[model samples]
Structure formats: C-alpha cells, structure tokens
Target: MNALLQQLQDKQLIWLANQTEAPYEHCQSTGFPALDQLLGGGWPQHNVVELQSHGACAELQLISKALNHSGSELLQVWINPPAHLCAEYLLQQKRPLHQLIQLNTHRAADALWAAELCLKSGCCIDVLLWQNSLQLTQLKRLQLAAAQGQSQLYLFRPLQTGQQLLPWTLSLQLMPASTGLQIRILKRKGGWQQQDLLLPWAELYPQFIKPELQQRHSSYPPLSRVS
Candidate 1:
C-alpha cells in the first residue's frame, strides 16, 4: 500500500492537481454568437488563424472582439485597412478606444510586419492582421513568430480567391453577410472542415440590413465566382 501511494504521488494524479492545468485563454468576441461558433469558440491562445477575403469582405466584429480586452489586459491591434474606408464611420460602429493599440498605415506590408512583431512579443492576447492582399512569405514569417512566442495570431486577407493550405491551425474565409459577416472555416484545427458560417452585425448590435436589388449594369463586368 505504501508503494502504491508513493507511485500515485509521483504521478500527481490528484483531483486538485488536475484542476490546476492552465485553462485555455480564448480570444473574446464582439459579443457575436454566430461568429464565435464558427471558429470553435473564438480564437485560441496557442495557434495561428488566418482570415482570407476581398471585395468588401472584412472581419470587423472579430477585430472589435479581439480588442475587447479584460482583466486590465491591454491588447494591441494593428490595422492597415483599405484607404476607402471611413475611419469615422468605423469608429461610430465600434466605439471606445480605451483598450485598443492601433496603427493605421497606408501600406499593408508594414501593418503585417507590425502584427508579426506584436504576436512574438506575447504581450497581447492575439495578433490580428488584415489587408487587401497577403503574400505567402509574409504569412510563413508570422506563423513562425506566433509559434516562437506561443501566441495566437489572426491573419485577415481582403482579396484572395485560390486556396492553399499552410501551416495554420485554422483558416477562416469570410464573406459579407447582410447583417454582419459569414465566417467559413476552410481549415480547422484537428482536421475539421466545415461549411459556410454566417454571423450578422445585428447579432452584436441593433442594426437592420435591407438588401437592395439593383439592375446589373451592362458594363458591370462578369461577376467573379466567390469561393
């Protein structure tokens, strides 16, 4: 009996010890339920997640949620959104700049570099990267940084059509929804491939979307197939 007790103690197989395992720190949401469900309960603490899209395809809710820091935690957010976007309108949509550490630059490359640095620093909950286009090299670098720091990085690409699996835990392809955005997990951690995940802005706020059907102009050009 004494030997058995010593073996059990060596393994530390007590209930109290089991309870002491570190809980997975999740990236907070913008209070949106739909989006949260798509990415397996939001961004996780120890992996890299990429968001790829273009042509009005963005993840504003996700961004807002990531910046919604708590526990007196200061999370940094680096953005290089398209120039056409109205920062004022964006501010109106998402208020309170107290928890944000944003860097608004015209060059997407610069913004991505900044995001990689922040992720490696491990000072922020997770790094969010967004831009019109993303290069393969840049993404690989970011992944390495995230791994080195043991931090989660969220990469968003505004315009990408083809699909190529990289060394990422999750790859979410976002589409613009009438209310908010649809988050489709193209590649999920643990080899889970799910279909279209839709989340509306109305889920987070009291906004109504009225889809206006307009006649397609002759020169409107052929619609590029949305993947």
Candidate 2:
C-alpha cells in the first residue's frame, strides 16, 4: 500500500494535504502578483475556472494578461460574451487579435454547444464562455472535454449561482471596489477559501481606474494613481 501510494504521488495523481505541491504542471500566470500567489503559482492548465460577478466589474481585465500570454497560433475563443468585444481594446492590451474568435449564440443551449465544440477542438488555447445558468452535469462534461483537448475554459456566471459550490477546478467572485477589484476565492483545488482581497489597479491600468470626484462623507477616497 505504501509503495502504491508513492507511485501515485510520483505520477501526479495523488497529493498529501500538507505537501507543498503546485496545483498542476505548467500553470498559466494571471499577471496579478497577489492572485498568482493565491492560486499556487497560476491558473491550472486544462481545467475550468468559474468566475462569478454581479455586473461589469473588470472581470475581463483580470484574465486579459493570461489571454495575452497565450500564443498566437492557437485560437482564443469566446462564446456568448456579455457584449461585443472591442478590437481596439484587445490591441491596446497587446492581445493577439488575429487568433481571437467570437461566437454569438443567442440561446443558452446553443451557447453550451458552441463552448463544448470549441473546448474539444484541440486548436484553441483557451475558451471564454459567458453563461448565466449551468448544471453540475454540464460542468463535468465541459471539464472532461477541456482535459481531452488540453485547453483551458473560463466560465463567467452571475454572482447568485456562485453560492452553490460545484466541481470546478477553481472558482472566484469579483466585486467592484473604490480602489480596484475585490476578489474572493470561493473554491480552489488545493487551497482553502479566503477573505476578499482588494487589488489596486491604478498602477497596472491607469486607463481603467479613473479618478472620480471625492465625496467628503464617503468611506473611501477617490481611486487615483499615486504617482
């Protein structure tokens, strides 16, 4: 039994809770120092990461760095995005515009179908799916497809559904903040749930974090770049 357990550990199939092990080999960097540290190096490859947000809260900006790092050869597919992605913004972020693919599936069923097809195609580096509703069975199917194709999937959902923990490799909740974005780690493969982490964005993206008129009685100061 000891030898078998040792072999499984060597093969990366099993891990001890106390062992300092990375989630998976060759994890992708999120480009946020605090987030990267929280995710045990970076986002695990070939796994689904569920990102939940109430409304427009800089969620795309959170993963823009990882998408930019994805090579130009393999495609970065987006299915049922909240809105039409701006080409100029992609260019501004240094993303490979030529490798980007967007699919507008009006129906929920069609959106899932399109997402599954893209994830199982093996030609895509990563797939972004904006879906408000999903089931445990659907998530499991997508997870298997992702592993088969060796691609990553980012499923965007409404904040309400984030309360029920599912089988996603990782899950995060994004909330708008006065300074930047508040990130909560809802679920992680080898990590415990954590408190809200405020990531100040003025230093990283000045254009996104605008200066607003400060309210005298407000709890926090207006968000602005210190420099």
Candidate 3:
C-alpha cells in the first residue's frame, strides 16, 4: 500500500489536502492585477485551467492578457470554437494573429485528441479548448500532456458541472456582471477557495463594458470622504 501511494503521488494522481502553493514551477500573469493576486502570481503553467460559465460571458477577454504576454513566437491553438473568432478583437487586444490557429474537428473526441496533441507538441504556448463536458479521466490525460510539453491549456466548459470537485490545477466560474466578469475561484493549486472577485471591464477594457456601468465609477463619491 505504501509503495502504491508513493507511485500515485509521483504520478501526480494524488494530492494531499494540506499542500499549498502551486505544484508547477512556473506561472504566467492572467493580465488583471486583482486576478493575478488571487491566483498567487498568475496562471500555473503545465496544467489545465477550467473556466465555466452559463453562456457567452466575455471569457476570451479574461485571458487576453495571457495571450498578449505569450507574444507571437509560439502557436496558440483553439479547438472547437463555438463561432468564428474575431480577428479584429484579437488584434486590438495585442494578441498576434499570426500565432493563432483554430481547428475544427468532426467530433468532440477528435477535438480533445487534437488538444492533447497540441499540448504535447512542445511548440505551442497555449491551447484553448471548448467542450460541453469533460470526464475526470480525460482531464487527467490533458493535465499529463500539458506537463509533458511545458504548456498551458485554457479549457472552457458549461456551468452545469462546476460544483463537482475535479483534479484541475485551477477552476473558475465566470459570471457576467454589468461592468465585467464576476469571477469565482472554485479551486486552485494552493487549495484556497477565494471569494467572488469582480473584474470591472469598464475600467480595463472600456469597449466590452456595458454602457450603463461605464459611468458608475465616476458617479461614486471620493473614497476618503465616505463616512
């Protein structure tokens, strides 16, 4: 039993509850200062980060900073995007169009297969995969693939299975807010369950913020004067 447990730990299949700090050696900034702080510096590299939402909730903008941070050197693969990705939006955000590649697979299995391949290729910086649901076993495979290639996978999923605890390096729920995304950190490498953090897009990305909330900040009284 002892030997088996050690093997599981060595394979990263078992994580002790008290273990804190990211298991990975490196992490990249998520772009938002508040988010970076919440994530303990940035998104952990060589791991799967699961992002869940009810529907389209400006999730792409959430990772826009990371994309820009990676630069145009390596490939950034998108597997099974719901709709045509906007080249203009990516360009405006400073993400290199030259490095971005979108792959459309005939089936979901094919998409996951492609994602694993991209992650293990060692030439891709990041892989963004959109799938309706994922089995825990499948996540483990992706996680291993990412670690092998020293890459990151930003996975998008529906909100239905958000409550279930999984083995992902990080899990978050992106709720749409008037100003931007109300992000809830479901899980992380450090095992810290953070509170819901509001990333005001109006302040960061003015173009994506709702019109009503654009002036909400200005209308507030000065901070020191509040009694």
- Candidate 3 structure quality by residue, lDDT tens digits, 158-191: 8865367577788888888775689888877665
Worst 10 residues of 2 by lDDT: 209-218
TM-score of every candidate: 0.60, 0.80, 0.80
Candidate 1, residues 48-140, lDDT tens digits: the string is 667777645446556555544432354645565445445675477454355556678667677877878787886665565656555668767
Model 2: per-residue Cα lDDT over 112-180, one tens digit each = 888888889999988999898889989998998899888889999888643675866788888878777
Per-residue lDDT of 186 in model 2:
81
After superposition, which runs of candidate 1 have C-alpha atoms over 4 Å from their true positions? 1-30, 55-58, 70-75, 84-99, 104-110, 132-137, 147-152, 177-180, 207-227
TM-score of candidate 2 to 2 decimals: 0.80
> Ranking by lDDT, best first?
3, 2, 1
lDDT for 205 in candidate 2 is 67
lDDT of each: 0.60, 0.82, 0.83
Report clash pairs, candidate 2. none
